[model samples]
Target chain A: MKPSDHDNEHLLHHFSDMDQQRESAKLGMWIFLITELLLFGGLFGFYTFYRAWNPDIFHNAHAALDVRAGTANTIVLILSSVTIALAVRSLQLDRRRRAGKFLLATVALAAVFMVIKYFEYSHKIHLGQLPGKYYHYTGIEGTNPHIFFSVYFTLTGLHGLHVLAGMGFIAWLAIRTFRNHFSAAYFTPVEMAGLYWHLVDMIWIYLFPLLYLVG
Target chain B: MAHATAHKKPHVLPLKVYLRVGAALLVLTLVTVAVSFVHLGPYNLVVAMLIASLKATLVALFFMHLLYDSKLYFLVFASALGTIALFIVLTLFDTLRRGDIYEEVSRPITPDAVIYSDTARFDTAHGQALPEEGLMPLDTAGIVSPPLDTGEIGEQVDTSDIGRIRTGPGEGGR
Candidate 1:
């Protein structure tokens, strides 16, 4: 198809037009998110297996987690998701300045999430509630107290990496938005990044309750 | 070349949609955290998971645009979720119901099974050679081979030193 006025420079030749291109990109991103879900699903399975085996131990070990910090991080991530979604919406409306601000807010919230995560991890390290053979905390009564920490570190550690990646995505979108690279005609990147950010938040939504508030 | 198909303009949802979804998500987050504190026994997990699922659905439908986008995206995502459910459920089936039938016999023998127990001996002299008394019946009762004299070999190899992770079959090289 020949390039037309409706088609922006962002639209690739492989697609019929901007709509097709945007939908294709979003589809691809969703597929990638599926794989990401499966990856975390495996860990979730491992967690379930161990949690079932050591119910009492899991119950006790989870108590060591700071509910306040976890709750704070949860709110931070949810708010970040909101900001990224708003950023996409703003871009769709051709409000470039507002979109940039929303993107910046998302990045700032992501940093706040990481800072809280840093304190949580350092506190665990201090208490010697380390995973595997390095576990030295004797406060919890369990045959293998390290098992809970092992699952804890693996789940949250992986999720933290995703948070950092999401931050990078939003920051890049922010820079691009400020440069006027995205507008109402083509904001696929912003939308795709929003999807990625929301997925990260979704994973944490599951993680927070499982890790911090096991009943 | 001119194409016959005219692509419809991409659907842009209203800001109100986002704000409402965002508010719902925040409220649900608070609800999940609050529910966690109520001590619902086993139901606590069920409630937590249900609330989390609801929040995830809202994000997927509104924030991620699945509600406004093509059904293909929703199908692809739901399939992934179904697969994950299978993954977790099948794993739990194996682990949670293990040893339900045969009890102790069906369960996996621990690494410290008597055959690899502290008192069990590794006859390095035999090293893949058939026993002089011919093949013995399989026994997990810890008596796989007779104990050999350590002094004759000039070095005592303590199998127990391998601890919980006793390597099998290829230890003859040591």
Candidate 2:
């Protein structure tokens, strides 16, 4: 057997073997991802119920959101998800330099998404179109308009926090790749990071239409 | 071959497949924007959500590597999503089933429409002043006499009455 394979065979006390350890770690990550889904799911449920209750108000209020900007961000996030997936693939092939480059691309795309979001949020704040009671703008005369912005801000704000966290993870992973910390033998970190980054993109996929395109 | 199998790497889709998925996602986004302008009435929302769902599925299956992962991971994700969907549906059922949520909100603000559950204060729809809904809310000038001392005084003013119409500048509920 190869020296590395011999080293891997000495399993930790908690794990019966290398296969068990790897499978358990993966299953743990999946469980955590679902829990994260549930957390966001609650807020999403809130938006769904309110949207159904006041469909017209949602329609009128969402007009203030810039579709162009939202569309751009959606594309940016999709690109980032793709790059991160590529990064994981590169690491699995033991291409450290390629993996690092893809990680950089993913981080760059996430930065672009946040920058666009900053402009969108600043515009809303400037107009005093704040969530709940702070909504002061009168551009549209509709019932319970504030509720729409309330849901909008709440959903986007939470999703944005996830994006920020994902960016931090990608940056760390990239730096680690530069140090040759991952190889085909053990590259679970890159794969896990890729999973998380895709989730961020998946959320924005839903948000883009709900907030900007449709009522 | 046996050595390579023991040291196996996780499955990775080709670069071409990833690029193709990215292209499809971008195209679908554009389609969403285009569909919004067509004015499909209620269907507009349905179509948009469907497209968004398609994009999300692609990202999850390809980019997230769920397609190549174990069935156990699939089960976890599916159950979470199913539960979330149930929560939304049940909450919406409760909310949509309620009575007068919209009527209560819109009755006061509609300038042209008259209000009055039991009787019309005036034929506001005609030349008469708009009714205050089922209850005629009167201003001080309109009030024939001061309300008599009542146990309910200094308590929550019934907004349905005109005496408290436009309660205060900060009172956004009205």
Candidate 3:
């Protein structure tokens, strides 16, 4: 028997083996991620309805968004995704310390993303380009300009929360890695967390183009 | 258990693969952003979405390791995406159709066809306007009364000319 084949303590009693346990966890995470997708799907549906109904308004309102900030955030998320994936790969190689460092790098990148997002949001708020009834910006020349901002804020806001949650998950993984809790045999949590971070990046992949570029 | 199988090792991709996918995503991101600047008119959305989908596929297949993993994960993810497509398509069908209905229903009535000369209010084609007090019961039985206007209030709302106003394009309730 190979040394790596020995089952570690991470295997649950219900699972027949480590492979089954890891596959189960990964499958469960994918399922939950889809649920998250569905939740965002509803908002996307709302956006489609409004954009279809008032194409002119959506087009005009999109100009209010800072594309520079959005592009920066997009790059930040893609980099974070890389870092987190590397972190998982590190764990797979049993480089626990390196895994923690990569995880911390991802966290730092996520924080930078939030900072850029904060500036964009505050700028919008300062200009009264808010969602719904609070919308008072008079620059847009169309009916119900507020509707576009409403969809924008809601979609990005929810996505931001997901980013925050991913950061938390990665931070937890980093802590666990420092404690020497995971190795090549039992890094399901790190892999799962990496999947989640990628999912978050995937969401931004769509959101960036739709909200900022598509108009 | 029936599902129990031999221990399978996790797949670990090389650093180059991750780096390559990461570079591709960044390039695609820039391409999408750059594409937005060129006015494709309506096709802007199409092109942007296509590029973004390509980027998302790369992330799913490589960074998320769906390419290396079992097909079951891809199945679940693809089905979820299909469901979202149905949600958006069905919703748009309803919303766009409803918009057409509203446009048809709310058309403005033309001003030339005078229904009630006394009030000059566009007759809602229903002719449910109350007849003046002490006046003969309105001949609301589809009688084409002359479009006469005395231009005086309470001058006996001409029941004889009661239903003559041909309701214009605004007659939508029918």
Candidate 4:
């Protein structure tokens, strides 16, 4: 082993250097994201089947949900995704301060998404519209409206948890950026976190329509 | 050699592309909401889901950089999706088959005997209180009624009894 091999603490010693480590990390994250998509895919399939079988019930239940809030959240998540991409770009350019600013913006946008989601959920619960056996909306005519609420809450709740997780990840990346931990040559952390954040945003892109915009 | 590779140029998308992607997403959201108002029957849900899937693809491709990922990552993603597809098909088959099983079970039993008179009356009223019948005159009375005893219902249907027979032979015994 050469003297350069001694500095392989960050490189994991298995790969040749930092570039390989970065590539591996990026690949691993993509694989993890694929699994995440699959995890949610089951719910998506459930929604598809139930909606196909009981279109009227799903549409009526979906109408009870707030489309305006969902649309606002969709925009918020999309903008945050853009900001995180820009943060990665800034890091690639070795603009640490600019990168931190973009990351902070991304975090703020994520907070906005969560705040909007919180209000939407509280409004629904206040109106006695809950998931599963607790659903109380009886005026609407449907075979099993509870099933709609069941899938709605399950999918959106899982997506919300992911958004929370992404917020924490972005915050950590922001802190590291502030400390000048990433450079043009070593910004894989920011890139990987951006990918995860984008996945969270992507899931909402589908959820907004499936849950709130359905007629 | 690896250090030299690390010094190579990084891949980055232009700001304009990001802006355009954002605009496209916003447009798609509006389009989906607008399309929901028209009654397309079965197609409405299909169209909505398709648009949502398209939106997800855009985000995954441009925002998440799946477009830039290596082939191995794509394979991993494809396999996961394939597994999820199998899960969906199998579960749906089971659910659909359950309805058939329920119908077969109901055919062997006398349904009218198992029906609750109060429940039947409530349904007959079109989910409203019929003033003429004077049944359940007060809303609170229905809610405050004593809970039905499971043992009583079970005892009423005995296997040895001819008129009131258990639907399943081993059901009540357990």
Candidate 5:
């Protein structure tokens, strides 16, 4: 099929037009998000198993977490999620400059989340609260407190990596958006990236309370 | 009618809706933190998880555009979550029900379960003060004491001399 101003110029021949292309792209992203959910699910499953087996240890070890840092990062990610949502809205409305700015804000907020995560991780490391057999912090003691750090580091480290990846995606999307490549007729990339960014924030929404506020 | 398929735009959430959802998420996070400090015993975990799930729902609905999206997308995500929940529940079912799986009555005893009276040797003589058969040193208030001369339990250990954590399997090699 030939491209029309009504559809996206980059529409492929296999797809009939841009709407078809956008629907297919979104469905594809949702499929990919399913797999991503499963990937995180494996770690979360392990966490549930261990947490159930040793509730006391999980709670005790989690008490050492910095609630302030966790809370701050939660706020940053929530704000970033809002910004990314706004960026997608702007692209849908043909406001390329405003969309680019929102994307940049999302990227900056994601970086801040990563920076705060780094500090939280470093403090844990300095206190010798390492994972598995390497855990050496002595204040909290329960049956295998090391296992708590094991789950903690695994979950949060994976989450931090996702944040970094989302930032990269948004950064690239922002650049393309500023190049005027995206308009109301064609902003699929921005939407897909925004979905991914939202998943990052979604994962942290659970992680904040799971790891930090276990009580 | 056929030409109508060419211009189906994606749903764009209003700016106000996005802000409302974001504000709700932040408020829920605050509520999660505030509730964690309250000692509701077992209910604390449940409440924390409930709040976390609420926050996750908000992100998925508003931030991910699932609320306005096709039902197929929401179905896929919900199915994925259901599968994960099933896996966790099943695995925990096996792990939680093994009360007697680790117990070994026929084997040689491992030094009387490492009692408080003696870490190396199991001496019933030191436990003579206790009414029970175990070596638990209980005060009149019925509190177990650590073998160390340090203060009561929950005190931070002397971590100044603590070296790097050991890094091996069953090495206990600090």
Candidate 6:
């Protein structure tokens, strides 16, 4: 066995071996992801009720949102997910520089997504389409249009927060990649981070259509 | 020759499959946008949600590598979905039941009560008059009626009072 492998064994002492450590970390990520889903799950449940009760208002409100921006963000996130996967793959091949480059690309793509989202949200707010108590779009006049905006803001706001958090994780992984901290046998952190970033992307895949495309 | 036996089997998907999956996701997004233009009533919402779910599945299976992960991960995911489903069903049941109570309470108590009215009384130089009760005239007459104890419009029904509507349990027992 390599001397470095023996030295690395003590680095993650929670497990008896590196394989066990990798498995546990992956499992821990899935559990965290499950909790994350449930957090969004409550908002989704609220949406279903409001949509069923006020379908017309929900549809008309949804029509006001920009589908093009949503679609662009979806594509951007999907591409980022691909790049992050490639970063993991590069790490697995012991190419730290390639992994670092891919991580940087992933972060840049995420920044692009956030920029698009900022414009999308600000445009709506400028048009007096604020959510909940801040809603000022009395022109579209409905019995309770505020409810639709409430669900829209709550769901997308939570998802956007996830994107920001994912960016931080990606930045951390990028720093580690720069330091040549990960190799074929020690890339669990990068892999776990990739899995989480992909989940964030997966959520946007659903949100784009639900909030923007459909009317 | 001995080095060949030491290599571990690759567990990842072929590169072509990933590319194809990516292409399919792109196509699905286009399909979703196209579908949204049609006015399908309630089905419009259903179709959009269904398409979004399909796209989410593709990303989860391929991009997230859940296809090769342990069953424990899937169990965790399934449990989350199950919890969401429970919340949807129970909350909808409660909300829909409340709608029925609203309908019952909104039913008029008398033929004259068929038209909903907001009663306002004004004091003037002349005698008091109930506006909807015809004590006030079409153009010239000015009369005021003290806020009478006429009771609620549906008060005679004994079941659809404000208390019942507010509490949701009085008339919603069924």
Kindly indicate the candidate among 2 and 5 with the higher lDDT. Answer: 5
Give per-model TM-scores: 0.80, 0.79, 0.80, 0.75, 0.79, 0.78
Q: How many residue pairs of model 5 clash at the backbone?
A: 0
How many clashing residue pairs, candidate 1? 2
Lowest lDDT block of 10, candidate 6 chain B? B156-165
lDDT of each candidate versus the true structure: 0.76, 0.74, 0.78, 0.70, 0.75, 0.70
Q: Which parts of model 1 are misplaced by more than 4 Å?
A: A1-7, B1-10, B101-174
lDDT of 4 by residue, B1-174 (tens): 233334333466777878898889889888888898777877866898898878877877777666865667667766877888788888778645543332212111122222323343332323322322323232332221121233333212222221222332222222
lDDT for predicted candidate 4 compared with the true structure: 0.70
Off by over 4 Å in 5: A1-7, B1-6, B104-174
Error of 4 at B13 (Å): 2.0
Q: Which predicted model would earn the best DockQ?
A: 1
- Residue B51, model 6: Cα distance from true site in angstroms: 2.1
Clashes of each: 2, 6, 0, 0, 0, 1
Candidate 2 residue pairs that clash: B115-B133, B116-B133, B116-B134, B117-B134, B137-B162, B138-B162
Docking quality (DockQ) of candidate 6: 0.25
What lDDT is reached at residue A142 by model 3? 68
Instruction: Score candidate 1 by DockQ.
Output: 0.35
What ranking emerges by DockQ with the best candidate at the front?
1, 2, 5, 3, 4, 6
- Candidate 3, A1-215: lDDT as tens digits: 32434545666778766777788999999999999889988988878876876788889999999899999999999999999999988887778899999999999999999999999999999999987657778898865687788899999999999989988988988998999988766788888889889988999999999999887
Ten residues in a row with the worst lDDT in model 3 chain B? Answer: B104-113
Evaluating just chain A, the predictions reach TM-scores of 0.96, 0.94, 0.96, 0.92, 0.95, 0.93
lDDT of 6 by residue, A1-215 (tens): 33334666434655655555767888898889888888887887777766766666777788778888888888888888888888877776677899999999999999999999899889878877876446667566455465677788888889889888888888888998999788766788889888888888877877787788663
**TM-score of candidate 6 versus the correct structure, residues matched by position:** 0.78
Clashing pairs in 5: none
lDDT of 5 by residue, A85-162 (tens): 999888777889999999999999999998998898899999989885567788986655776888999999988888
lDDT tens per residue, model 5, B48-136? 88988988888888788778777888998999999999988888777666433432111111212232223333224332233344443
Looking at model 2, give its docking quality level. Answer: acceptable
